[model samples]
Target: MHKRTKSNIAVMLVLALCLSAILAGCGHEPDKPKPTKNVVLISVCSVRADHMSCYGYRRQTTPRLAEFARQCVVYDNAFTQWPKTTPAFCAIMSAKYAHNNGVLRATHGPRLADEHVTLAEVMADAGYQTAAFLSSPALAAHSNIAQGFQNVDEVFVGPRRAVLPTIRAIEWLRKRDPKKPFFIWAHYNNAHYPYRASGIPNPDMFVEDQFYDASRHVRALKDPRAHLKADVPRDHPCVMEILRPDIGAIHTWAVLDERPEELDFYIARYDAGIYSADASIGRLLDELRTLGLLDNTIVALVGDHGESLGDHNYYFEHGRFPYDATAHVPLMIRQPRGAGARHVSTQVAAFDLAPTLLEMTGLTPPEDWDARSLGRLDKDTPGDNLVFTEAGYQLDYMLAVHDSEWKLIDVPNALDRQMMRHQEYELYRWRDDPGETRELSAAHPDQVARLAAILDEWAAPWRAEVYANWTRNQTTIPTETSRQLESLGYVGSNSSEDEEGDDGGD
Candidate 1:
């Protein structure tokens, strides 16, 4: 061959080798037996799963989250182990059920035991900067909640909202090392109570924001006499409130805007909070993109639990009773682009979150974790299993076990609903009767027995031993994971309570 021809042939050979190397690189997964250097866990506190547009709420409280969900795996039947904050997170952070952790209500959340392992500690041990910006007051000071963070930022953001945390986190992200990997827990609590009523501007129509600022009125508080459980006088405050004609107030539905008006106001305010949250999130995402950290990161967004807006007589709150309005929630998962995204509407519980995060970050949870990793679940693979959840009789006492198809609620020795009516219950077939208008314990005896047995068994092995202790003592100090109790005005000077656990034993 001529000299020029030989040179050309050499060039082709080199090009072919280069192409091969790139192809191999593309096929290779991240270093196994080793942690991926970059991942983040951001929790939106007090934001119910159902309140977001992604979860079928009428108002668009979470446009960004909804969009983000498209890029991630969204779980339909996700549920929080415990409804309230401390215990719910105790289960999530430790990957254990409330029963095992001996956590029931707000005060129940003590410092996690030093033996317990957290995703933060896992990432931190694997050489990631494990930091937490506890935005929610629910997990703030005087609690053992910040057990596993190098940056235990329990900074008091005003109103337990996202304003301060958002600002602080953005600043921290900007200052942190780009090459050093990190595990950040950015929590927001703007969606809880007070509903951002003032700045809502328009209760009927408003941007996604935190807390509505609309004025409360009497006319809108009134409902039908039949709707009122008690024989409230015709001129009672609730009756009179619903009859008001004030167009300025958020109380629009004179008929008691359960889902339509009041719920609308609630959603609008949630959006405002989410608006601020989304702005913060967008800023963080932008920073990642600017730092070129976008593609290398894995982000998972989820609710600790859900909220209720008069689905079954429980209005504007949760954990009041065993109802789907407060249990069913949205769970989102987004890996890098080439990683592919699949929507798994199958029955996956939020308890599955810990193991899933661990597995996604290339870490396996301990054998004791009842939760399962989504990394183990195929995209279209049917997760044909019933999820089990229970709350050790704490702030509110009820035994519950549910599947995608149905749920059974047992409110033993309960009658005073609304802090007035007290009664006990053995209810079943909640899926068919969402309002729980019918109690079918007598009808589906076998199902009730099976479900009740599961709840008992789960609570017995994991919870009974510890709960028996709490039931007996009922101390001023809550069960280890009791932030919610503290938030609710439990001002016992028990600084001697157990601290939040930060076990990083490898």
Candidate 2:
């Protein structure tokens, strides 16, 4: 009896132990995740390359960037998703085309769709500390651009708010436990509007903000209409009024066309603004180098969009179609010292920049995303990509896709007989006539047809995005949000775009 009892008790104890082990094993947390790799992306604005020496410009506007470019892969033909800041930045941050994102016009304050995925969120999921020092309202927190950033200092204006981003970024970098990973995007707005570095309180910001005076402002603002002599087609007389407002104060921003000397003066002012931004950036770069984080990180310098500066009958600001001066931007991808070939001429878009950076850091882009990594696409595996851009009214669609030599512009809803927005469509062979003055739609109908087909096919999916984002003020206090978006330079207030005729292309 004692032996039987002992055997039963031993069996019961063994069974209980097995059960406990199974339960405990099931409850045990998986291996602690791998430490995230750190990545820092620095996005600047409107620092035009033609105005800088890096892109073969006569001016010495970008001394700091030139040094960085030595090891970086510089893209000569990197274009923006949209010519305006908000839409363009939306494309860069969200990694989506502008039309699928939102209207990229001034006063356009539509919030990004909640469904849209951001690069920061992707990195954050991979166990990284996401942060952004956004110095521009063009990327306001009012939008979802700041969704994944744990410590985002978006108040990049005023003195108190000014030092915080740089100070905090350096502090975070210094204090960050090496065990954890990091992802930071330091967006600099020093080159944007209200052009005054004197108010910035940093002598290093600009060489001399006080060089130019009110007289320059007054003279440029006078008769702003007279400056629209950029070979605009005869029928497009109204373009002068539609693009640049008669508001006298706007011209002071950039005296592009008034006097040749003003061009020098205006460029000087812009150069000073660049210096201001460069100084701040140089500080951050120094911090990363000091921390020894520079080698492992891929620091990319790119403008969200570009400015016209009186090119092609355009003014200094952007909110138009992708003209050469406004759309073509400077892109420098400085990976580990010898990782990439020195420079590449692969044509890419702003929307693709984020994905490329993510890919370079060994992250996979979402399967449905439209952009591809430029690093992967080299001369050995060169890809001829057709980048699209939009601006102006929805009804005013401009579709441009080029193969190095030929660029075609389809301005649908042209008005006049000679392509002043009268006719339904207009096309131009850019290689034959780089200015795009000739209305060859009627002359060479086949080329126009082929381009139209290409655009229609590419826009089909983006059209679906249009219907999805279209709606009335779903958010309460819509006015303030709209105003914030307007301040960010997105065209139009928060309003549902309902018109069927409103095409998404520009």
Candidate 3:
């Protein structure tokens, strides 16, 4: 009987051991690997945030984009670091301000310095198939914006249309390995200057030929050698007849006495361009959906810089100043897996895009980058960080510092006597006066002094870096590229002495 009891006890111990092994098995399972994601970044040239319906603009200038915004995170107060193509893009790709990237002027410096690590390089390092399709000569391969990109297409030089780049991107997407992740940076230039009224067909209202002719004449006046001339004074009946009726008295560089109606016509043409560009973006999005890539890809649409469009006496261009008209741009991001739609009111800068993108893709940004990741933003978050902007060539420099509420524009005394004669410092409460119509520097001396001091401190490092690496020698642009740029009203001369005039701003 004792022997039988011992055998029963051993059996009970074996059963208990089996139960423990089963519990251990149930408690844990192997982790599944995370799915790889693709990233597509589209940078539209000369897009103003306020012009889109999504931003509360009355016009249906961007119906497609409005719809797209419904599925992405739309930043309401996104501003560019610089209001020019090359410099702005340098900021976007390098995650550094233009001043730090050493590409302050459009044509003044060599391509973005080799030291600055680019977004493409980071993606490539992480095994991404990187490609870029650029629509502007200002971002040509020689410009070094193509660094670390496996496939770079700068062939689309004239007219700044979006169709060709979209097609190229589609082809590249198809050719890429399906198993590996990819990154594409496509730039669209349709919303750029020299508005083509002809592109928009059968609009609700048509601009008269006289107004179009006048625009051409005004552009010709910028050329010192053009045969065309405005024989009549700007206020003469001949010019006034084409001016819009609603346009009140306003200052403009095109002509001193432009009619409100004429300005409206010009604006209408710009809106048409925006509509066309928005449609192109819609097509690209549709293609992604068709390929079943939309669900797994992170798509970001941003404007390199905003167009002035006759704001603050700056007409039909950018880069002359750091006003909201030129600095504020549209920034929208659609995350993978339907992250849902949200609007961020916090002020964000263009340089922040690169770092934000890296973080979204589960990658780490370089510690030295000036841009901070925007991934932490949420509905309850408040923006208290200051954003800085700078643009100039040679002796003429304009710097702006702003937060959500206040903005300060500082134009230092330069060799150009005319610019010096104007207000050296202009302060505005941006929230109260979005148009920046009034200068409050005289009214609030303390505020101006405070903001100016902050701007100076923030800019000290960039200023010192740019000065140390300054190169006076001109970059040798390809002949074809120069011709294309000149045709687009970018550069006036090929001579190195004329580099300052190249101001490939918008």
- Write down the RMSD of all candidates, one decimal each: 10.3, 10.8, 10.2
* Top lDDT model: 3
Q: Cα lDDT for residue 448, model 2?
A: 71
lDDT of 3: 0.69
Residue-level lDDT of model 1, residues 114-201, one tens digit each, is 5667666666777777778775445654445456678877643244344555566667777887767777777765555445422223
Locate the minimum summed-lDDT window of 10 residues in model 2.
497-506
Report the candidate with higher TM-score, 2 versus 3.
3
Flag the better candidate by lDDT, 2 or 3. Answer: 3
**Segments of candidate 2 deviating more than 4 angstroms:** 1-36, 159-165, 197-219, 222-261, 379-383, 415-447, 461-506
Q: List the candidate 3 regions with Cα displacement exceeding 4 Å.
A: 1-35, 158-160, 197-223, 226-261, 378-381, 394-396, 414-421, 464-474, 488-506
lDDT of 3 at 431: 76
Alpha-carbon deviation at 477 in model 3, angstroms = 1.1
lDDT of 2: 0.60
What lDDT does candidate 2 reach at residue 237?
A: 18
Relative to the true structure, candidate 2 reaches a TM of 0.73
- Residues 188-221, candidate 3, lDDT per residue (tens digit)? 7766644442224533233453324334322213
Between the candidate structures 1 and 2, which one is better when assessed by lDDT?
2
